[model samples]
Target: MRFEIIGNIINIETIAVGSSIREVERLRKTYGSGRWRKLKGTGTIQLDDGTICEAELHWYEAHGIGKKEIKIKFILSE
Candidate 1:
């Protein structure tokens, strides 16, 4: 879903890294290579419908490629 992070993400943690990431190959092909990591964090987000909620977010990132394919794993609160 389309949304914007309202503030900083907290409790950030790496779920996977490099070759361990299931989508590493696709990530590299689409975004170029670096050190890809799959990470998750909790933060407040404003959805396209204008609903604000707390959510868990997951995405892939590399040193210079930045965050990619961010998705909400689930909503924590409304």
Candidate 2:
């Protein structure tokens, strides 16, 4: 999965195909530390069925504008 911390929001832009939810949670834990709190708001996840899954992702980091990008990934079960 591709993770990007844009401005004050932690963006999990491109989660690779077959990636597991645990991986996402790990990424959340990795980034959800120090001056970072999970962003509590509306978000969407597109499933393989082409159906958009609406949910809130608890992941974010407290930083200044145009912060550095953070990326991580994990293989998923087929």
Candidate 3:
């Protein structure tokens, strides 16, 4: 699913780090190496259909590689 983050992500937390990440090797191959981390946070996002929603977002990040493979893990219903 595709979505654009609207603003800052609150409640940020680390889900995994380094070898703990299942796709650590793949991430290094694809995005280059660093201290890789899997993290999740709650933020506002705009969906492809132009609908805005609050959601829990997950993604991989490294010191210089930035965020990659962002996903919406859960949506908060109105």
| TM-score top scorer | 1
lDDT of 2 at 72: 23
Give candidate 2 misplaced runs (Cα > 4 Å).
Answer: 1-34, 64-78
lDDT of 3 by residue, 7-28 (tens): 9999999999999999999999
Q: Tell me how candidate 1 scores on lDDT.
A: 0.94
TM-score of each: 0.96, 0.32, 0.95
**For all the candidates, what are their Cα RMSDs to the real structure?**
0.7, 11.8, 0.8
Number of clashing pairs per prediction, in order: 0, 0, 0
Candidate 1 structure, TM-score to reference: 0.96
Q: How far does residue 25 in candidate 2 sit from its true spot (Å)? A: 15
Candidate 1 regions with alpha-carbon error over 4 angstroms: none
| CA lDDT for candidate 3 | 0.93
Question: What are the per-residue Cα lDDT tens digits for candidate 2 across 38-73?
Answer: 333334444445544444344334444222233222
Candidate 3, residue 47: the lDDT equals: 91
TM-score, ranked from best to worst: 1, 3, 2
Using TM-score as the yardstick, the better of models 1 and 3 is 1
Question: After aligning candidate 1 to the native by TM-score, how far in Å is the CA of 46 from where it should be?
Answer: 0.4
Worst 10 residues of 1 by lDDT: 21-30
